[model samples]
Target: MDFKDYYVGLGVSPDADEKTIKKAYQKLAKKYHPDVNPGDKVAEEKFKEATEAYQAISDPEKRRKYDELRQDYQHWQKRGGRGDYNWDRWQTNPGRGGSGSQGHTMSPEDFAEMFGGAGRTGGFGGFGGEGYSDFFSTLFGGGGGQGRGFSGGSTVGRGRAGQDTEVDVQVSLEETFNGTTRLIRTGEKQIEAKIPKGVRTGSKVRLTGQGGPGIAGGPGGNLYLNITVSPHVHFVREGDDLRAKQPLDFYQAIFGGEVSVRTFDGEVLLKIPPRSQSGKKFRLKGKGMPNIERPDQRGDLFIELSIILPDDLSEQELSTLQELANKRG
Candidate 1:
């Protein structure tokens, strides 16, 4: 039956404004909300505590009155009068109507009826004012005549939205190029998720109403899938562009010809210019990864030429190469 400090409960200073009090209440409410911590009695208690604190400090008049009470209680304690103050009013009297008994035994229904029309639906964000504590009831004249409504149970409904869920989805680079559908397992069901073309690593997709189930008829939440793209065997991604090395024979580098180039889509014929040296680069437009948002648009693919010599040379080939070198000298 100690004095409840609304400011300390709400994690705000004595001079905190209404907005600051409201912010603190909202943060604590969300953390300890029954829906987020299902079947957890500790969280439920914390939620109620936060709700009560918010109710007392959110209103200017109530805050002023509570501050006055707090100051008086503190002054009494400083003067060593804490033992003399009547703490019996804070406790509930079990008897129906004792002659000199203090405090009243209040039921949940009676408690609800007392503050039924007091506009207990606003101020704090959607946490509701249904399960207020007896301490709160006593301060606002809803203390059930004499004894405060000290019932152990609350009268609030458990109507709260479900929590949002996040899951990681791994996709290959090829799958990103050609958008594919994947069967993702969530909870007790498997959902077919469509991976859009051009989805890169760290991309996120949201599915509506696919998160944890709500409580007491509240709306369900959303599910977010974080994309993790695997590395390609022969290609590397740079932003929206793709890079790869294409090997060409020494003859092709000396005497131009059509060489086959491998791309995500398929193989394409690339024309090699005459006298093309080793390490030459070529840009193939519109052949890279697609834009995530703009699937129709694609980036360019860069190809670096790697010239390779014949592993073994015949006697006639060596004689011809020597004659060519002599002519050049």
Candidate 2:
């Protein structure tokens, strides 16, 4: 798959804000949804493309990664560096239309280091240390130490790599809480994805080199899985914490006792203190979702108390209540 220009795909500018991105996505999604364009393969493909593009750029982390990759690719082209330069042959082979001894081969890394490390920090080319830079130059040829003649004389054939693909996967709150695996159908293939414990909504899972097929046997692109967690019936997610209301009877609120509470794992017993207030909350440490990237860390769970009252009371109960009130008076 050729890499889709996300901004272009969404018909927005590179500097578009979150609101603009969302608006574009919603408008495009509604118009191009598969259901709306039934049996129209072209429309369906467009819809899928738009959806994938939106999914990639809408996320902060994924956007950052995409930006880096794009910058690297652009720089690669701008440098006029052919992907398939043979440094060994270049070093041994003389420059065309010049003295045979004048030609020298430089590795890609060396070429980058010599050309100011490819103009960006920590990227394929700019500013790597002397040792690394020299190593690459020796391997690929065309580094800063060599003149521009090396690239001009060589006629190396470079293969274009495949473009990346993005997909959005929505998971239920229960699946997120307990960690589950699902099979996703894309185009004609089914991919099995494992939802790791502690992944939050909007987290992305990267399947390296699984996107579009490579051109001329080069490495294929990557597949990005954007996750969306569905809302739970009883639980609300706050960061890693899970929050829910636990209803209690008036008597239970006034006189403490053991009450059953629901958790992501299962039902658990929670003790209510005597004279506990209706708005009181309890925290269950390490009960919330796991951190998506950090498996060892877990979030906390909070339970808010709600007091319920009976609609009617027996005559004996009413008499007992009256007597208690009289004694208090």
C-alpha lDDT of candidate 2 relative to the true structure: 0.62
Q: Report the Cα lDDT for residue 57, model 2.
A: 74
lDDT values of the candidates?
0.69, 0.62
TM-score between model 2 and native: 0.56
* Per-residue lDDT of candidate 1, residues 183-205 (tens digit): 87778978888888998888877
Candidate 2 at 131: error in angstroms?
Answer: 9.9
Name model 2 segments beyond 4 Å from true.
1-155, 323-329
Listed in order, each prediction's TM-score against the native is: 0.52, 0.56
Q: What is the lDDT of residue 266 in candidate 1?
A: 90
lDDT score, candidate 1, position 316: 97
lDDT of 2 at 13: 88
